[model samples]
Target: MVSHDPAPADPLSLHGVVPPTVTAFHDDESLDEETTAAHARFVVDRGVHGVFPLGTNGEFPLLSDDERDRVVEAVVDEVGGEVPVIAGVGAPSTHRTIARAEHAASVGADGIVVVTPYYYPLDGRAALDHYRAVADAVSLPLYIYHIPSKTGNELSLSTLSELAAIDAVAGVKDSSKNVPWLAQAIDGHPELTFLAGSDSLVFTGLEIGCSGAVSAVANAFPELVVDCYEAYADGDEERARELQSTMFEVRDAFKAGGAYMSGVKTALRLREFDAGPLRSPLRLKDEEATAELRDRLESIDDLEW
Candidate 1:
């Protein structure tokens, strides 16, 4: 494999609202490819810049290898070149991650999102080696999925700079909840597209030189999310701030209800989609949380698009 620093395209090419779409299941917990694609169609139709599936929000770690690839294929087929589709191929093993990246490429994903290998803590050098190997393995551009809270592997800023120098690393999705770090990272490397993974930071991220966000709230309010970005882009700072605040409120409400992914599924079910039950070790037993989400969504629904 060659190591070449291609001239950065826009330095913010992978911007805007891209949802890590939730996988749909039937009553019996069978993979519901139809509804999964339908939700992708829903968000794309509502005007997102891209679609990502099989992230933490999408239950990637919980899914079988076959399920992961199938979800990517279904979304790609349904999206049909309408929007760039980035599929998460993060696995604890580098071998499995490579296989997932290859499968994503074969299934028509525009790029791949790779989270650092978890379960055991790794130093900067080890993480760099892992990403470099995967970068060499696939031609599709790779975006680092840096969510330490769930993965137990926190990527340091210095380490991130080293990783960014690699030829194939196109961007990063920062879910560390560190605005200062995000701002500093974006400034440090203006070449790699930086995307915030938190909804509350959409406006702040963009304001601080981030291209856009890879969001969970976007699974429900695609239009609203895009509108917020558009507002910021259009120079309506006030409008953008207002929308961001609303999304922050929604985020807090969802947090109050239950966990991250489950609340997102609850939002989908509220809007009349078939988001079905969560997989094992997880259950939708919180009616109070669901009702809270419903009311909050209703308030959002009443907001003018």
Candidate 2:
């Protein structure tokens, strides 16, 4: 089994809230570097374990290669040594993924989270080879992003265990949100740390031996997340459960609106941050849903910023 302390250099391991930060954009749809870094600083100030840029919440696919690199740079520059900055370097092709990973290292990211290639399905061998190549391609700690709902490929148990054996592979951010499945992975492969990727499952994940969460809702309620994780770590199960339920409330409020990522950004804006808007193809236009989101959040007395 791998040590719980995955790496000596990075204190941000598997056991805390790491927000898949919303990418800040100008009204004209260009990247906003200042607002981007500011948001990172804001969350870090709330005591988040780490910051992840360019994941599903960050609008990774909509971003060009250059844009993604610049976003990582801005986030890394802001986060500094406060926490390990885990950048999502996954791309459709292995070549492009490696390029992004290399660029992430150049920009001083402490680690890289590589989601499975999307659009195309992969067999076990292909998936295993893809991760092996990515791990071999870079020296940085590689986190496997298993978000099968968005990415068509799902890493099978065997493939994941095999990939976990690779020394460079540090952990798996299981966004699938399958608690039983995640538990199996956690028990089956002790060498790899498994971070709960869903906001709703953060507490449950920690209960079942997960390191922590890479949450979308954490973008808005970072302190709630940090408190929940700390409560669990401190053995306050009652408080942990309460905060965990509150997290579910926040998650339900966000999901009630159709555009998932957009609702997250909207929540950020509601909190008075300049989180900007979603890019093309994905829009946040539901006034009713947005209002309902506000109502649900406001009802949570203990979930204050």
lDDT of 2 by residue, 1-305 (tens): 12223333223454588899878989888999889889899889998988999888889999999999999999999996888899999998999999999999988998899999989988888888888898888889989999899897888888888887888888889989777788888888766777889888877888777777898878888999899888888878889889889887887778776766777887887888966778887776478887888887899877895
lDDT by candidate, in order shown: 0.83, 0.84
Q: Quote the lDDT for 225 in model 2.
A: 89
TM per prediction: 0.93, 0.94
Worst lDDT run of 10 residues, candidate 2, spans 1-10
> Best by lDDT, which number?
2
How far out, in Å, is residue 8 in model 2? 8.4
Backbone clashes under 3 angstroms, per model? 0, 1
lDDT of 1 by residue, 1-305 (tens): 11112226533267788999888888888899998899899899889998998887788888899999899999999995787898999999999999999999887888899998999899999999999999999888899999899889999999999998998899988999888888788878877888888897888888777778888888877877888988888888899889898888778766765776677777777777767888876766388888876776667642443
Question: Model 1's lDDT to the true fold?
Answer: 0.83
Per-residue lDDT, model 2, residue 298, is: 90
